[model samples]
Target: MNSAVIRLTKCSSTKCLAMFQLSYHSQPKVALDEGISSHRVQVGPHRLHYLRAGHGPHTLLLIPGVLGFGWSNFKHQLLGFDRDLFTTIAFDPPGNGYSRPPEKTFPPLEVEAETVAQFMEALGVESASVLGYSSGGRTAMVLAALHQRLVKKLVLASTHAFILPDEYKYSRSLDCIEETWNEKEKNILYGVYGKENLPKLWRQFNDFNERILKEQRGNICLHLLKDIKCPTQLICGQKDPLTKVENSWLLHALIENSRIHVYPEGKHSNQIKYAEDFNMRVQDFLMADEELSGTNIREEDIKLAKANSF
Candidate 1:
């Protein structure tokens, strides 16, 4: 498929204009349960679609990666977090999921971060504890660094501060969806972005990574890591091929008040594969009054976190 065809298939000018003009009245009501409700709001030029659950005092914002949407990436977190203690909001970034029309232009991470801040403001959220997965983590890092007061805490899962040479090569290899993704991965992506659009989106995402590598020297937010003052948690899978465990360790080293959790047998999609453990650890970190770092975490604390998860 040629670039022109892909661009047309993603979003036409007429459809894009209609989507933006009807933004206020086009929200469709979709509810998973009594607690989870789906909504859409206009954030500047983009219309953001999000899933909101719980009525707790604390707010948790979930940012998905690459071809990820709110429900596709954060099903476990949407259903598992204690409704009494936290209100979770998972959004589909512009051009992905239900938030479309503009298609993904792959702007700078700083621009994406600013859009996130605007999203929160549109939703009347003053501040939130943010959780970002994969590429979304890079955006989260930018958000925390540029808008420090808007983020209460931060979580980065299976992500990196900058793209490595190996990562760039791997991204290049993913141009062809059929050859790059496993059966399960294909099914998941197919469900979120239809079978026809999946390949195009994947290719576009790969191109975005390549641009970052060449133009920015793979730097997403490495220079801004030190500016992130919020208490942070870095979760990684030891066996992940994309963002390895070393990425998490490096993040922990750079972010002063940060801790690391490595899942032994987990892969790139560990958040979904190891949902129970991941949820517990994230909950524990967010709920803790004191900052949690590698130096302070203990065996009993782990047990306590597991106990309090439910």
Candidate 2:
């Protein structure tokens, strides 16, 4: 028997677009009635593939990294949050996963923000708390700015607001004209989490970075982040090599009623790596804070949500 060694890299090309399946070994077996449901939405030239799960008060709208999608990367999020307490939703942005790719340049963050608004409206959800990771975080900021009423609160993980001279180089969009995805590209994919977890991390990084670089324009993220006004939470790994600390400072300063949290030994993927702590902090912030809070959630209820396996 041979064990597969998946390698991730910082490649920005089309050749690295390999179809890899994620084994469901990471999630716990505590049945929570969490499965994926999909929908097709038209946002300008792009048709987005969106996923939804669970049910409760205060819907959580999850936005994944540039090209990341589905529940695999967001397993911690889906599993950690009290599914019976809050309705959680995650989706594939344009040009990734089951979603349609862009026809022209990738839609701007503002445009994508509107698309999200449209999605909520179509589903009859008046408002939701926006949660974004990586470039998705930047997009959430944009959504809050454009649809302030619909966005009650915001959460950002491993995201940057504006370009820093030092940090811009790390983004695949800034480094290349058109990113190509291939099996062999030396990127932060493999070594993002030291050397031991390189194989797993590499696949995750390559799956996201490769497609995002080819389809997205980096400036959209920078411009839209400056306009946020909702209560926001920014979480980052202290050891994140790509997004520097200064960017979080700038985001916190620009966005009103925003807070920042840094995991001591965490990296860019801290939310996944430190799922227990990360989920606890998020639950605490959303429930305790007056501005961000609405419905009351019991801690005991969170611990005991069960799936109806009928």
The estimated TM-scores of all candidates read 0.83, 0.66
C-alpha positional error of residue 122 in candidate 2 after TM-score superposition, expressed in Å: 1.8
Candidate 1 lDDT by residue in tens digits, 1-310: 1111111112344333211111211322223554677677889988678888899998999999977878778988998998999999999999776676666667888889999999999988999999999999999999999999999999999999867788777777877888778887687666545677778887887888877788887766778888999999889999887886666666776677888889899878777999988989999999998965555455564453333221
lDDT of 2: 0.60
Candidate 2 structure quality by residue, lDDT tens digits, 129-201 = 8888887887788888878899888888888754444544454333331243332222322212222343333
CA shift of 197, model 1, Å = 3.0
Cα lDDT for residue 137, candidate 1: 95
lDDT of each: 0.78, 0.60
TM-score computed on alpha carbons, candidate 2: 0.66
Work out how many backbone clashes candidate 2 has. 14
Instruction: Give candidate 2 misplaced runs (Cα > 4 Å).
Output: 1-36, 41-46, 101-105, 172-227, 291-310
Top candidate (TM-score): 1
